[model samples]
Target: MEYRKKNSITGVLRGATFSGLLLCMAALLAGCSKDPAAGPEGGVVTVSFAAPAIGQETAVQIASAASQAQNGQSPATRAALAENTTVRVVAFTAATGNPVQANYVAEQTYYMSGGKLVPCTVDDNGSFVAVAPDAKMELERGSYDFYAITPALPLGSDKATVSVAHKVDYAASATKGVTVDASKTYTLTQLDRKCVRVTFVIKKSANFTELTALSVTPSGAGLSMPNLPAAQSVKMGADIPAAAGSETLTVPASAFTNTDATTATAATVLLPRSAADILLTCDLTYTTATGSSRQTSFSSTAKNLALEKGKHYTFTLTIYPFDVSFTVKAEFETTISDWTDVPAPAYPYVSEGRYIVSRDALGSSDQPLHPDWTAATMPAHNEVSAYNALSSEFEVAAEDCNSADASGVTPNPGNYQYTWANALPACAAYTQAGTSAGQWRLPTIKELETIYAKKDGLTGVGSFTSYYYWSATELSGASYGAWAVDFAHGNTDGNGKSSHNYVRCVRDI
Candidate 1:
């Protein structure tokens, strides 16, 4: 025959139809040395599509449903479709056998999100169909991948997919941007249910191309808490530790202006805990894609936030007090007459006079006075003065009662032979200058405390008692009377000088 090619064979066709025509052309062109469309189509032969062999697995098949239909094949030649027609091609060094879902993009739009795009879905059922199969369609043309899921198909192993490789794509949009914005605060309905909700207003709409995600950041995204004045300072009705409070804060939409308000709400989320002490201060901040920040202080007694005095607390911050300091000094004070509601002196006043007592109470039980009860210091051997009482005989030193012949000190020969007469001269000299002067007069009961030796509770200021001594401190309204510190149970007691006690005046260096 001369020529007669079907018009359908020469025109534009689908992958299957075009593929069939190309096959015929290739066969016919093999014999002739002519251009494909240039020669006659007389030798065109009638042929049928190969049978879709019934195999355990659809790995072997001549054509898919549509292709079989177009080729006018019998159901026997058209294999009933299997749930998953894995139309993947072998790849070099790629996973050879894994039921791995295919990565894909739309053939029409070539838009795929992570090689897997979910069609609009319904709650109870799958509604989408596969648009492309594995690496079957123009594999080398774009990024090829095995189809992952068909929403219209059953889930689990029951799913059938049209794997596809898509051209690298993006969410090319009208605009692209990153922003930090606060939400226009609405009535923050703190649902008693454990949540704080503030309606935010969108300041603007941002657009981006190929962008798959958006991130929002909140700078000063915190609840406007009331100044947490110290619970003690606040004089709260409840225990300071149990005081409770809250505040109504005013927020504006401009806080998150220039972006989607919803995003602003999500980008910058503020949280306030009832259990936590909160500080409320006015705040404002801004940001780009990088970050956001804010500053505030707490209202409390110790001059700062309820933050712990010696505790470790942390937060996203620029800087914090690792150790801060200041200094102070303390002191001791007193006033002798500061007693409230009490008289200064508890004893009655007395006048100088002579009194009699046992010889021992004067100086020694058997000693004699150089002169008499009112006797004055008399010059004599060793310049010794006569003693009046035995009370201090064992307590007072011989030198304290007498002046020396040549040396500054003069003492007795024996404890019992010591005569008050020997002490008179020194007593007179001291009296002339100033009776019992310069620690040379008489010993205080306290000083007498040292009369004994540290040896056997008999020494040092910690021991010694019984002897009556003189005190420079005059009795209130009385010249000759004085107070004395006694080692007897370590107390303060008194007696008149002539009633006869020891003399040991104190001298300050």
Candidate 2:
């Protein structure tokens, strides 16, 4: 009986020892355990993308502006990844020793929806605003290699070999030794696009009244993948015709929108990354204020242009009139830059009741100008009326200076008061707001009246005074008299050409 009691006590002691050991182990495990937010050993793998890098050649290079085309057309445009861009990601098991031994493990496709990558099966119902959690890629804690492609190309037998045809948009990325730890999110390097964006910036001169239509065809253009092995030919794909040889890309008129009176986004195209002559053929159809229809064809070749991938190119073309047909002294400037949407051109600084002042009255450094004028025998009232009825203020202003003296004589000869001849030359010589010579002219009687009417609403016009202002229109019946407007009283009357008065030069918007 005494031996049995001893055995029972020993058994109780053994049980207590086992319970204590269990408690200690439980406490130790609790201390080592960490919350998922505290960087655990394994968690969800969240993917992100880095920003794209800018090209090295960012300056604009000036080249010949001669109008000639291989196939025909012209440049400013931007191409960007679409919001709903689909991306296929192939994950490979990292090699234990050599990275070259990596083996493909799994692959999945995701789409860019609402600025975030989501699984393909997660239907957003086309709203793109479906409230869903970010895609979670559960990967074991290990190093991995990833290959990503946009528009999700079929992964054929050769994984390392990529086939890029002459497509408008394409991007690819290959990342090696991407360590995925439960500790933090893994971000993929930025995808590199295989094409360049060319934007054509069309600027209109004062002579360009309207742009009825415009189209561009880029000839001898093809795309290539330069990121491949140097020993391998950059060109691939025997099945794609565009990849075999140069192809033509046509930018329709619908892509270009006239944003303002001066400029328009002519066309934007995604050109291939091949070294070839970029020939632009541009066809323009429009009408001039001189009552002539103009159809101009401009073509130029950017020789041996090895367009860089992911770069934006801008080709600016300013409209030149062919009526005079002078040698085009101006040349085109090629600029490498980031993709940007052309801002609308600002114009019509002031809105008159009927007329718009594109810029402030011609003057010195935005100051109010008053120059006297004297012209030979002025047109008769009937003749002046007929001229006004037949032409615009811009036309009348040009004709008013027909008899301006060209003897290189000093203006305001005898006194500060300028004669009619001197006034014409003075207005013709003045330059402001980047205007060329002979662009500014004396305001007509009707124009002066409108300016006075909308004086209060002048937004960006130069300073003005409540004084008599000369008009391009001559007095109806006087031989040496012209019409003038009194801004103070809104009175209109005939005045002698020798009379000293304020002059306000203007140009067509």
lDDT of 1: 0.26
What C-alpha root-mean-square deviation, in Å, does candidate 1 show against the real structure?
Answer: 37.1
Runs with alpha carbons beyond 4 Å of true place in candidate 1: 1-465, 489-491
- Alpha-carbon lDDT, every model: 0.26, 0.48
Q: Which candidate leads the pack in TM-score?
A: 2
- Please give each candidate's TM-score: 0.16, 0.41
For residues 185-304, could you state the per-residue lDDT of candidate 2 as single tens digits? 455545655554656655554443444433332221121222211211221111111221434455665666666644556434353444555555555655555546656666544434
List per-candidate RMSD values in Å: 37.1, 16.8
Candidate that scores best on lDDT = 2
The runs of at least 3 residues in candidate 2 whose Cα sits more than 4 Å from the true structure, single-residue gaps closed, are 1-82, 95-102, 121-138, 206-244, 261-274, 290-294, 323-509
> Residues 113-175, candidate 1, lDDT per residue (tens digit)?
232321232222333234433322122221122222212222233122221111100000100
Lowest summed lDDT over 10 consecutive residues: which window, candidate 2?
324-333
